[model samples]
Target chain A: MASGEAILAHGSAAKRPGSPWLSGFVAATISEIKSLYREPAALAFTLGQPIVLLVILVAFDFHTTLPNGKVVPYLDVLVPGLIAFIGMTVGLNGVLFPLSRYKERGILRRVAATPMPTGSFVVAMIVSRLLIALAVTLITWIFGVYVFGADLTGSAVLLIAFATIGSLAFIALGILMVAFARSEDDVAPLMMLVLIPSILFSGAADRQPRPRPHRPRHRYPRPRHLVRRRDHPGRLALQDGVARYE
Target chain B: MATIPAPTRESASHTAQPPALRVANLVKHYKKFEAVRGISFDVQPGEIFGLLGPNGAGKTSTLEIVTGLRDATSGSVEIFGIDIAHHRAEARALLGVQLQESDFFDHLTLKEQLEFLGACYGVKPDTEALLGYVDLADRPNWRLKQLSGGQQQRFALAAALVNDPPLVLLDEPSTGLDPTARRQLWSLIRRLQAGGRTIVLSTHYMEEAEELCDRVAVMDRGVIAGIDTPLALIQQLIDTGFKREVVVRDATLEDVFLHLTGNTLDGVSLDDARKED
Candidate 1:
């Protein structure tokens, strides 16, 4: 084949609006998923760790007394918090470790040398990590409901919305961490520095769980429910803007 | 004949149709170090261009700029008439890069790896043909790490051709290979040039530069020291009263070694699978 013809055959495909980028995203996501499956360790870390934590929380018969004098199961609160934690772990390791590895081992350099846009590659990464985070969220939610008998008292959509937003926020933070770090080794401490605090403050596994009592005056901070409460206004405003634009 | 056009002025457009690759006054400056200082050259279509330099001589930096991996501090690179600095994606469409390090997802088989890369370019690779060309047809299901150094380099070469790019950039394609492996890679590169692709390779091996490159650019300290065909460069030196202290022998030690030991690429380690070629 003529050289120009060869280039033209592939070049035209890349010219399509969003298709090239979307293909890049899809390729990256598929490759990531495939690689994750191949790595039992990575799979255990991303999927199994959260499940193991849930199992521990359930196996221990953990219960916390709420301020409303009702005893809420630990699974009920920890599951949601774990959703954010899932976001943290998946987002952090997903983007940061892989990105650093790619940069170090020349994977990023190899791909960057191609015609593929850097923006698309990054977006693909975020999308792929978000996907893993979403999978974690789904598995945990299912585990919470059936396995542990945790009630889905709130709207499922709202849970997903909060989880999605939390995951995105963590993913963004992971990118920031990557920017600050020089190598893959440097990311560990940096990740822990940010990761531990976010998980603790977000109430995924806080030290304190409010005890039950007939005290109407006291408002105890619920960690798991905090995601919905804190993010509900932002979600509402987003919906409002979308409605206004529509 | 592909003449070495005098280094043109920065930012000036060529009167003729643009070459396959043109790098003019390219410079790359890190915080305190200048990686590439104002280097300029053009690659004619269908020629095997070589950049000969030591480590940290800015050859890779220059190629990276043309490939759009790193940004140039000042100046421009055009690939097939499209300015890479401005029209990167378009320019990138015409280029393929095989880096020194073989960077493949370890878990992925060769076919899957090529499929992923092809998807990145929004094209479906003819995987069978690519594998066949790289002489890895029998080992399509092999993971990257399972392959030997030579096999990995071959796989990388296959990956570079997934898009059938007209301009292929190979950065030290045979860096860590044994002599046989290096020769196999050189033959593969020659086949690429035979297939009408313009290849720009970077290497420190004098033999590799002399044997494969149509023209060689000798770089030092981020600058182009000289640019010419290997024959012309040698001829110029000979005309300037330069003489070799030692007599050149027709049968060298490398040739004797290859003759005593069969020149066949050792593919036995890859699951007892021998290459078809």
Candidate 2:
């Protein structure tokens, strides 16, 4: 809390369009953080959901034994899946719930009346939630590595790239969801409806039901060099390229 | 790109400043409905202007357009000589707005709410004095959800005044208040006016208009039915030979109710308390 004179001084300073935009951005971010920290339920739900899921995943211990007498830890396999799951859940729920609730409660309308741009306000909120998601993911990844001895087989850069893409995708989906939703009440059901299928069916799901392996035909024998996915155009193109090479 | 508002001739001169707020030929069309149609008005620098209307008269729509919250079909709004369409942030800096609803983050405490909103305006407010000014100093740590209706509205008022802007826009500031609370709000509004702050508010209460507004714009069906000082409007009606067959008594039912109810301004009133439930 500052003095009245300080506030007046700041107000006069802010009146100029020439004033640094960063101050307003910083203020909006701080406001977003304050509101976020104040809501105990929201804080619990966001942080708790991932931890609860991790607990369930660890308890399941769904493992796979490799061909070379090596046993692959289930947590290692599940970690990537969990990352995607966490990314999607955080990206969708983190942004949509508050955004829709704010719109429904006229908070957005009220902020729209202020000097702060709604774009910047919304961006601040999303960025804060994204940071929270980053923290949650880091914690989960640490637990996977230390507690479960999960092997990090792939490039960390690749994992990060995929996570970032997944996050962006889910956030875009969340914004689309909010656009269709009339109010906060509309958000919950829509999220549940969308997320349940995604969690159950997406490749992020634990132990996806492997499809039947396709057998090559004798007439136009599938190229051994190309991975088998007869329905995919990429596989077809690869087969054509292999034939041309042959 | 062509939508940018070209600098108007009026703002070119330094001595002749633009009005505090100006809306010209404003129209808002939502699908088949025209919420505000060709409406226009100018608010002076230090006047308490009232928009008196019933529900669905487009007062909020007009206010929204002026605030740059919603796009108009075709119109222009200038605040402190800056066209809102071109320079929304610059113009918004000159305005303080208390929306029609007491919409705030439910989790944040009163002090936090003030600080958060103040930060949004890039202002560092004296939250203690601000809360004290709005008579909520004692309950600085109280969350928005914990506040009674009247208390919340008052807190919202404090939030609105956090930046100390020259013009304040209040949309139905006294809508849900008890009679006592409404009076308290009226006094607060008067205090602002005395401090030379320009205020434009919308309310349905005729008494509120007569008591607080320097000029009233009576709106009906998305257009201005009439605009004048409350007294002048009444005087015009009187001069036009409009009369009631039955003379009204000095004390109305509301006055009797207030007399019986003892004009409770405190947040402990049953209606105010019921908000939590």
Candidate 3:
């Protein structure tokens, strides 16, 4: 057939890197994270974006009153921003961000040269992103819980899962972005101009009127067992002037 | 087109040595177009071996296969009595390859890069010694983007040696360097060889191959046309009674440029490039 097809056919037998044993996998995972931290520009842009937004949203007062005549609380507004931030961080870090550098400078080819097992590179990349994304999510939650008093009524695990799946969705998008990106210069504009807008429209920013899967709850769905700590957002509202002061 | 030198058994004797690296009947193809058609040769240990060929002659393809970058269609790469097909890691551990290209984290220091690559080979080396070898000890803290292209190659070479591997691959190491920088790199390669490292390098420079390589493999269209010492290959073209063409050509324009501009890659441009204060 064609040359591309021939290359693909050969790629079907693409040799793998190293065995993914428990210890080896973990080592590869750490190496991947180290690689990410090594990149100053990428880490700064990826991690700093959300933090900057978080500070801006919390520190600045928004005077928008809700439909119920209750003020639209900063925490309520900040919740969607945090979710969007987490999703973007995970998806964009290695996905489309380094594709150009990898292609232009032969980083991917060099990495492929190492004997670190077949999928180790990708796995390491994803795992590192997941860890960093988790850190960002936790940081956002802490800021919400202490600084803004977010009303998280659902299961903590479910929230984490939702955020993770959200991250994965964007990460896939990021890979697709990389695939489309031809040169190193194409990456920055692609992310800023294309990826960000799509994510914002995906209902991550408002908890806005979007269709979500309504899972039928078992009548006695032990929602109390989810978090036992003192995290009553509504109660906090009552004690703290009901989002009127801060 | 260079003539294929057919030598009698006696002439082959003067060139033959124990093989540091050996390949037998190696073949790799994209589909119908064979990238490395059948090629074979032996590289002696501690000698700088050069694989010279024009672009698309399978120079890179062969290097990739030998260094565990790309696997062959069907062939064998043996290094120091270890076969690549079976004991890949063991064979690879014995060899350090300076890939034709690589990526480094922009945030990491030269020292940190060395450590990461050393760890890749499970090597615990004196990163200091490695840096000193490449003349980059002073700028260890600088990130990759801060360094010039030539310095980056130096750091890459140091990383390749972190394991103190017996066999090293240098692919087009001198390709982008200026004349003075190229001379500096040649000296460094000589030093590494002095330390008893077997180096296999690929390049298009006929002069460089004649100067640095003890044994040479000339390739065309993914196949080996000739494998011998540079002297013998040149001698093959001249029938008999060969007078050595050993006249030193006057120092060329690069030398003139070096005389006019000096050695170091000016400090003023670096100040402008350093974005981090």
Candidate 4:
């Protein structure tokens, strides 16, 4: 009983200690990361999928012809595309499914009853997803560079920066989807509707035949357009330097 | 069967401390329907107050408003003199809440869940002490999903106390428990009262309300029909010439069941029973 009284006294005395919101954010992020680690499906999707894609693409030995009749290994293009794909998957599926499930199962409500602010919970979700996305992207980049001798030639810092921004953008989109979704069940179909088109038009696979002369390439959705544009400038600069040296 | 002396309303009112909870004409409207129709009550410090009602009688809604989960359409709720509407975080710091359906993070073990909750409240709780308090010391590594229904209920109670809050709100804590489990929960709740914490619980079970609550407000149609001690409520009913169709007996079917089957809990071992002996 004395201990109980002491606990009550402490609880009353520690009301809203400075930076509870920050601690709440950190706890939530750690919890989310732990949850992600436990789910084999999520790990396989975010981490394993990209490596498998990298291997398959590299094994097929695809090459893309530049406008100047220079043939470059498709790994250069595929790596950036894989990075973008990883960001999109990690951001959308990562945030959307978990957030919707938490909301549907009253986990959000349970946490809301605590002293933590709702904004911190959402921000933590985004931060955890972004971390996973970055880690997966880094792993893919390393594996591509070391194993198959895929020529990166671009600055790693720029690639990481692009990945970070791309992941955040997709995470925001995921949050937006969760806002509209009524339950966890609603998220799957909605995710597919957005995801299928994004992947098909992302130019990540580039399996589509080159656009006919009359048809505009820009008309089709290029969700990975920014990723490709960011990759090209650095690669083109490096290739120009190689031509001059030769 | 409570070992601790129950605080009388008279003694509670004489204290200089403010009520643990005070609700004044609280109203909650959901779109087109009114859930709580302007209810008002005060729960004295150290009292186990019960909100008893049938389904959809707005007990959950009222508790939600008091816990700051739902906003009252009108009127005020004060927790230990702090207005909840204006200062929800401060009010929350003094309160521990257990929702009807307890859903925790999927992957965390029981100890991890408690620690995570403690971190949310800006406290580092004694996880061992907390787990032992809930009779879950032996299964600290078990996840919430792995626990039986009864164990989960007790764990939810422990989770509520992570910050060692002065006031605890439990929404149907023993709703789906077996008879033995329900009795076990009742004893644990009495122990909580013995520990000098104020408890506010909602239940449809009259026996639970009678067993645990010092004072109860019986709600019907979103309004309190009566508020008094269980003894007083029964006396009031008896005074109105209310006669039972069946003869009153000293023992109920629950007692008969307990008599036939042993009173030991589901997971506790015979060695543990011997230790208790």
Report the lDDT tens digits of candidate 3 across residue range B1-277. Answer: 2333333223223544545688888899888989998887776666788899999999999999887777899988898778887877677777777888676766457777666555555544566667766667677788888877777787777777766677788898888887656666666676666656778999998978887787788999988887777988888767666787697878878668877654345322222222211
Q: Which residue pairs collide in model 3, if any? A: A16-A118, A17-A117, A17-A118, A18-A116, A18-A117
Q: How would you order the candidates by TM-score, starting with the best?
A: 4, 1, 2, 3
lDDT of 4 by residue, B143-196 (tens): 898888988998898888888888999999999987777776776677777667
Best by DockQ: 4
Candidate 2's residue-wise lDDT over A58-91, tens digit each?
5543344334433343455677777778788888
Considering the two chains of model 4, state its CAPRI-style docking category. Answer: acceptable
Q: TM-score of chain B only, all predictions? A: 0.89, 0.87, 0.85, 0.91
Using lDDT as the yardstick, the better of models 3 and 4 is 4
Off by over 4 Å in 2: A1-21, A34-37, A65-71, A204-246, B1-16, B248-250, B267-277
List runs of model 1 lying over 4 Å from the truth.
A1-19, A203-246, B1-17, B247-253, B266-277
For each candidate, how many residue pairs have backbone atoms clashing (under 3 Å)? 0, 0, 5, 0
Measured with C-alpha atoms, the lDDT of residue B109 in candidate 4 is 94
Ranking by lDDT: 4, 1, 2, 3
Residues B144-227, candidate 1: write the lDDT tens digits: 889888888988988988777888999999998866677777767876776667899999999989988888999999988878
Q: Residues A1-246, candidate 1, lDDT per residue (tens digit)? A: 122232223222233344556777788878877878889999888889877887666655445544444455556777777887888788888888888877778887777776667777888788888888999899988877666556557888998998888888878888878877888999899888987787567644544544322222214333323433453322111132221111
**Model 2 chain B worst lDDT window (10 residues):** B1-10
* lDDT score for residue A118 of model 2: 65
Model 1 clash pairs are none
Question: How big is the positional error of residue A146 in model 2, measured in Å on the Cα after superposition?
Answer: 1.2
TM-score for each model:
0.83, 0.80, 0.73, 0.86
Clashing pairs in 4: none
Candidate DockQ scores, in order: 0.24, 0.21, 0.12, 0.31
